[model samples]
Target: MDKQIGYGRWKAPADVMARAMARMRERERAGGPRKAVIGSGKEALAEAIRRYPNDPLRQLAMFLDASPLPALIGRAREVSAKTRTNHGDMLRGAIGDLKAINMKVQRLDQLNRRQVMALAAYWTHEKGQTPGTVANKLSALRKFFTQVGRQDVVPKREALYEALAVTGVSQQMVTRQQVALDTKAWTPKGVVPLEVIEEVRETYPHEALLMELMLAWGLRVSEALGLRPHSSDTPNFLLVHRETKGGRWRKVPYMKDAQKAAYQRDVLNRCRQWAEKSRRLEMGYPKLTLQQARSRLYNVMAEIGVTLEQRGVVCHGLRHEFAGDMFFDITRHRPPSENGADSDWYKQNKTLVADAYQQVSEALGHWRREISSAYLGSPTKMSKAQRERMEQSMQLIAGNPDVKQGLVAAGVEQFWITGPAADGVLLRAGEAMQVAGRFQEGWTAENLKQVHEVLRAGVARPIQFVVSLEAQPQGETLEIFLDR
Candidate 1:
């Protein structure tokens, strides 16, 4: 965990890199998840309950605790500490609320449907939790029941929505726009306010380290704590924790420029000091073991009123801050989450936007490039008013040489608007076609089945990008079928 620090730039060591390679060879030989399937997480949960009795965090850390599983559902392993804490809190809160009203729920199976809806009602009415918050709490509780092999105990989301008088969010949460609309709680997708972090640091340094790691590397709470000595062995990139999502180890390179790179190295070096033998995120004496470290990390933050549940300033937002910063660093343009570029910016630079999306996706350790949409919004987040204006702009000057050059450069081309056609207008950017104002309503999905059926026909790849969200391209407002 120790690095030679004297003040100059830190370079990746040769012997350390060799040692890491050796470890990699050993790991590859060992294979992934060679351990037998064994019993379900329920078995581990029982053992946890026995050992920790009163500690709900430790109890869930048994097997249902990796940085994956029920939360992501087959995407990653582990129930995150934040998630574990929420599940515990939600379940206990619900049970206590039930008991207060003469209902009983001592065991997992005893949590009834009515009790679940009642809790939802109380959260919305009495406590005044937003639909998103209530929904997340219910989901966490449902995960507890699901992981225990007793999913039926809790009512479904439909019932919860009906009782709570709200709508269900997507399983794959598109939170970028939602965060923008949020009034009270804020997203750190852009700049993480330093003052808020300093306030946290003034209170708890240990917790600050975890938050700092997430800010620096865009790591999950579990991933941030799983930092190791070998994590920073590479010269260019730092190896993210091995036990990452889906057990896949990601190599996120050090920060791009010199100054930021030095700060990143500093963060990793300090974090590695906390890494211990066979324990994830071991800082000093008491902060040993994943559960202990994780619990302390979150518990302290909650105390400081910086948790997402608390709607505090510096919760899981640091990761989003990293995303926004990394995107700007790579693309030189702020992300939509940062309120940087509207859909038109993306429309003008599809290729550039795609490349930036790919890089940010890799930086965020996502195999699916589009998944970055969760953190960064889709390219076509142009508002109706914005689209109307762009549509009018395009209509006013469809054959302008400048627009033609810009659109063609991105492979999302707009044809000459000054052409006449039997149908609507004769167009020939990549392929010859007639686009009239009549069927523009057909451009629904991304021209990816969301748009006109005619344009989608006979083309494996979308030839045109739809710039307007409303597909109001009378002349040529499209040239953005996001192909990242």
Candidate 2:
């Protein structure tokens, strides 16, 4: 049968309001997030917005208070702490967007094709909302309509994307391999220089500190805001206090470089002073709730032009730059961008590569090293530098008479070099060192005595080795020999 309000399938707005109030009463027996339920819901809802017929935001708040879709939608009818994070705020944002274009939509049911298109443009151009954010906002719109018995008002996804494209937010055309591999690199998205932080510090000192922490430790915004000033700092490391995504706890170290370390100390000291003066060390966000704190910081960021829409960079990009900078600091190599070394480097220096990824992942508070690939890049192809190094070494070694003879005989040989400056030559020939085997003549008593010396420790480490052979084999032609 067709739906009927307060009968079957559909509950009147007042009926939902009463049910939610009753739930709150039972839960005081558990708490409340939503607007307070007043005497006879619909009447109170109407009165709150009767004066603001032009303000859609006020009207939506009234609608949410009276209807509260969760009361009808969820099996639990519970208002979670994450309600704002997931859906509530997103819905509000969509309605408020109408105000930007001066549409004056008093009722959400009045949300028309013109308003939806305008919102898409606002989010895309004015707000610079990411594609993921845009999708979530659209979802919130659908949910609002679905519960309010106005699903037909929601625009098709294709139409929404088309509207977004008008504002230059085109649909992402990703290939199957790209989707499966997930190798989008965000390195050096743009450097957040010290001057930007200082400029923000002049107005919003605390928000600037959060940005500083983000750049210094690769902290997510929530993690930075949720720090315990006293306990977070060990002598060398900063423990993520709380509010981690997925509750991940990580310890980021004060940098090894002297200047970086000093800067870290300075930041910590300032944070400590601020916490002591304004809030207890334990009260990371102080009197402000999570929503209030986020709104305040984001407003400040926008004012200071910290957004991608404003400064051509967003706060999250700090984490990307940090990942890139951290990888370089640890491995002395650039993090993968559009052009970076592929698995060939990892193939040979597996341990080295693993260690670098491990340290960076830990510092960034990500459990898996693979997740870092989104911020740092994963190169699908060989880099020019790596390819050049390998080809140059291969050409040089392959051209040699001894190397060619060894290759012809057994495909591999015990290769070594004894030259005037053998150390420098070996250092320069890093890629060649993999094939450069240790020279040991047959197991004669004299050759056996050479055992304990253990020339280049772990030569199967297929790397560099430095040693002196007993009897000088004349010239540098002593490149390839048998493994005997």
Candidate 3:
């Protein structure tokens, strides 16, 4: 017993510690040891518990005694470091609210779903947070709780929705109210007109150059500020390697037109000067935070007598203008319904438009082509010419004996084909054909069969078909039956 007690209290080997613990348990189970022996064993056990509390039982007891918010905050910090997000700030904000409310939530298990919902409600209604902001906060809290193994505190999705509804912040509710409230006509702001651009140039020369970089290259403000002349592989282009929002690198040329090459050269020299000045002043590279740049731009605009309504043109608006100009230059056709272009013109040029948008999207460092709308606006509706071409394509497909037989066998009664453009075709159930699918640009009979199977299986979205075509004319031929 004395040997075992000594092993327990001292910095002993692992085997010795194990033997000491086993013997102590055995002695206690058999009967109380002699008083002198028991006293020493109890002291050793206490010391062992303090030194190595790695047992599951000990951990449980510690968790039971731990305060909920601080433990969650600590766990959130660990998670944020791993994820490289701002989760710590979000968690701290919640804790700040809890402290303000004087809630006596001390234990990890003290927070129930109701309390969580109430807190979310407070942020939504009382704090007047947007539904999206509240949603993000709730999501962060859920992740934090899950990480800490306190998932019981996380509210159910339904319960959260209920809380949002009570606060009059449901997506549908907000969207409806917004639509009803937008009574007056409002043009999208930030499309810098030429006059406005000229005014900015004369007023703030340095800022105007930065604005021109964004306008011409579709560069983000951060991308412009992080530019280094050393990053240029050639005299006329620079490789952008900064951590973009899309997490990609792209090459930005100085200018497409040789006439503007001198201007581009001048801009590059000025950017180098700015970077050096920033380094000398120790004010940070590019010398401005995004907010500071925006504020300076706003001040310049104000000095030029641009109204709040006309102030829609910002750095991002310049990027949008770049995208729009690129689209027009590539397609040589405006979006359908814009500038009085008929549906036929749009349909004929759908592929060109899609290709142009995709090129712009890649240049802008965005992975999704759909995101182009934020800059380019919604795609124009299909033109009459496009409808006619689609109809012609469908007629050709129906004329193919194998394709027609397959369609009949698959119970497809009526269908209308839309495009084999840059994106793909939109095949909907027409007056006679009962099929719904979006076939790829080069779909075949097998692909059509797959679409038939998916529709039969009750897939709601348009089934994607992969078919091949041979030497179809740019906007006239519908030679889709030929395999690639």
Name the top lDDT candidate: 2
TM-score, candidate 1, is 0.45
- lDDT (10s digit) by residue, model 3, range 1-484: 3322111122234465455446434432433112222122223334434644544234323332332222121111122243423555666566567656665354333455655666776786678777667777776667545645555465555655665566555654222121111101012222335556567777566666666666666777766655544333234455555534433455555545464556556656555555445543111235567667656666765666554344533445566566655555566644331222454565676777677667767667665575565555443433433455456545555555565455445444333443332222333233122223334445566656654664445433343443323223133233333222
Q: What is the full ranking by TM-score, best candidate first? A: 1, 2, 3
Candidate no. 2 TM-score: 0.43
Clash tally for model 1: 16
Per-residue lDDT for 1-484 in model 2, tens only?
A: 5322222222335455445446534533322222232222345345546756767677766666666444322123444557634676887767666776787666544676666666766776787777677666766775566554455454554765665566565665100111112112233333335778888888877778888778787888788777755556656677674776544456688776677778878887777666665544533467888778778778777888876665666777777666667777776676655233446675677677677777887788665676566665554422433345344444444444543444334323244443312222212222334333433444344332333223232132233333335444444423543432
| lDDT scores of the candidates, listed in order | 0.54, 0.56, 0.48
Candidate 3: stretches off by over 4 Å: 1-129, 138-198, 232-237, 242-249, 253-294, 306-312, 334-355, 380-484
Clashing pairs in 2: 27-30
What ranges in model 1 sit over 4 Å off? 1-192, 229-231, 272-289, 308-314, 382-484
lDDT of 2 at 433: 49
After superposition, candidate 2 runs with Cα above 4 Å error:
1-192, 282-285, 338-347, 381-484
lDDT by residue (tens digit), candidate 1, 1-484: 6554122233445666567667644543543222322223566666666777655445545534432344342222455667667666775676667766666543443456667666766666667667677667777666666655666665564544454443333332211233221111134322245555677778676667777777777877777666554434466776664446655555677766677788788877776665533343343334367667667777777787775444444556677677767777777776764446656667888888777777777676665567666666654542443345345434433434443333333334233221122112212224333332222333333433333343354233223333433334553323322212
TM-score of each: 0.45, 0.43, 0.41
